[model samples]
Target: MSTGKFIVIEGMEGAGKSSAIAVIESILNKQGIAYINTREPGGTPLAEALRDMVKSVEHQEKLTVETELLLMYASRSQLLANKILPALAAGKWVIGDRHDLSSRAYQGGGRGFEQSIMDTISDITLKGFRPDITLYLDIDPHIGLSRAKARGNLDRIELEQMDFFIRVHNKYRELAAQDKAIITIDAAQTMVQVHQDIEKVVIEFIAATDLD
Candidate 1:
C-alpha cells in the first residue's frame, strides 16, 4: 500500500499561510486528491484545548516558559497520534498549518531554550516523524506582525516583543537552510506573486510524489 504524504505550511503570524493553504487545497481538489486539513497546537480535541491555554492571555500570573514549551509538545503529541499518523496509515494526505518546526522556532529560538533540550524533546515526542514537504513562507517580522495586527487582536505569542519574532524568523531560516524538504517562499512579495510561487512549489511536489 502507498503511504500518504504530509505537507506542512509553516511561518510566522501573517506570513500568508492561509492563502497558501487555499492554493494548495484548490490544486489538490482540481487533481482529485484526498487530504485532511489540520493545524498544530491543534487538530485533536485535546490539542485544541492546549491551543487555547497556550494562546490565552487570561492567566493571572505570567505563564512560565517551560510550561509553554511542554504544552506545545503535549498538544503536538495528541495531534500526531490521534490524527496525523492514522490518516497517513489510511492513505490520506495531511495538510497542516503548522508542525514541529513551530516548536523549534518559537520555543527554541524565541523563548531561548537550548537547542539540545528542544531536540531531545522533539525526538522523543515525534520519533523523527516529519513533513514530506514544508512550504515555509518567509517574511520579515515587522511586516508579518503588522499584517497580523491588522487582522485581529494579538494572541499571547503574537504580543511578544519584536526581538522575539526576529529570533523566530532567523531560526526558521536556519532550519529551512538545513532541511531539504523545506521550501522557503518570500512572503514579502505581493499576494499574487506569493500564490504563484506556492503553486509552482506544490505542482513540483505533486509531480515528484505522484500525488496526482
Candidate 2:
C-alpha cells in the first residue's frame, strides 16, 4: 500500500490548535482525502491512560522529569505502532494534534532535558519517522496563558511556570526554523485570521502533494 502523508499541528497551550485542526479537517474533507486524526500522549487506549497519569496533578509525589519524558514517548510508541503507522499503511493521511515535537518543546526545552536524550529515545522508538508537514502556531506565553485560564482548570503541565512556557515557545521557534517542512503561523491573530492562515497552508500542501 502507498504510504499516506503525516500532518502534525504543534503549539503551546491555548495556541488554538483545536481551531487549526478544524480548519485542516474541513480542507481535507472537501478534498475528499481519506484521513485519520490522532493526538499525542493520548490517541490509543493505552496512550490515553498514560496521558491521564501524566496530566493528573493528584500524584502523591512529584513526577520526575525523566518519568514525564518516558511516559510521553511510551504513549507515542503505542499511538504510532497501533494507530498512526497502520492508518498510513492503508493509504490514509494522518492529522495529529501533537507529536514528537511536543516532547522536544515541553520536555527537552521546558524541563531543561538534554536534546541527546530525546534523540536517543526517538531513534529507538520511531527510527527517525517524522511528520511530512508541521504547522506550528506561534503565540505569546502571556496571551496563551490568559486564554488557557479562560478555558478552565489547568492540567499539571499547563500549570508550569511562565519561564517553562517561554522556553517552550523559543524552542518551537528554533525547531521550526531548522525544518523547511515546518510552517509557523501567527496564532495571536484573530480567529478569522488564524483560520485563514491555516487554510492557506492546507491548500498549498494539497496542491504541492497533488493528492487526489
Candidate 3:
C-alpha cells in the first residue's frame, strides 16, 4: 500500500481553517479515502492538556512569548509523535489544521523572536518530519481579526493586537514563498469559492502524485 499523504491547512486566526478542514474531510469521505483530521497545539490526550494551558486567557500575566512558543511546540511534538506519525505509517491520510509554520509566523515574526531561537526550537521539536503539502489560507488581518472577535471569547493568542497578526500574515507569505510544498490561497473569497479552490488544489495534488 502507498504511504498516506500528510496535508496541512494553515492560516491566521479566523481565516476559516476549521471550515476548510471540514470541507476537505467531506471530499475525502466522498472519495472513500481513509483519513484522519486533527489540529495542532491539541491532538493527543497530553497535547490537549497543554493546549488548555496555552489558550487560557487567565494565564495572560504568566505567559511570555517565549513560553507560549515552547508550549505550542511541546503540544505539537507530542501530537506528532503519538498520533500523527502512527496514522501516517498505517497508510491513513493525516490532515492537520495548523503546524510548525504557525510557530514561525506567530512567535518568530509576530513576537519578534530571534530567528536562531525559532530555528533551534523547531529543529528539536519537528526532528525531520515536514508536511507533504500545506495550504496557506491568506486573508487580510483586519478582516480576520473582526471574524475572530465575532467568534466569541478571545484566547491568549487571539487577544493579541492587530499589528501582531499583520506581522504573522506577512511572515506566512514569506514562508510560502520559500517553501515549494506550501501553496498560498486567497482566503478573502467567499467560503464556497475558497472551498472550491482548496478542493481543486487537493485534487490536482493527488493526481500529480498519483495518490489515487
By lDDT rank, best first, the candidates go 1, 2, 3
Measured against the true structure, the TM-scores of the candidates, in listed sequence, are 0.98, 0.98, 0.96
Error of 1 at 162 (Å): 0.5
Q: Candidate 3, residues 1-212: lDDT per residue as tens digits?
A: 77788999999988999989988898888878899988878998999999999899886477877788889999999999988989988889999999999998998889998888988988998887899999999999999999999999988888888889989999999989999999988999999899999999988887777554
C-alpha lDDT of residue 192 in model 1: 97
What TM-score does prediction 3 earn?
0.96
Question: For residues 59-102, what per-residue lDDT tens digits would candidate 1 score against the true structure?
Answer: 88898999999999999999999999999988888999999999
Per-residue alpha-carbon lDDT of model 2 for 139-162, expressed as tens digits? 999999999999999999999999
Between the candidate structures 1 and 3, which one is better when assessed by lDDT? 1
lDDT of each: 0.94, 0.93, 0.90
Task: Report RMSD for candidate 2.
Answer: 1.0
Supply candidate 2's per-residue lDDT for 85. 94
In lDDT terms, how accurate is model 2? 0.93
TM-score comparison, 1 vs 3, better candidate: 1
For model 2, the superposed segments whose C-alpha errors exceed 4 Å read 210-212
Residue 127 lDDT (model 2)? 88
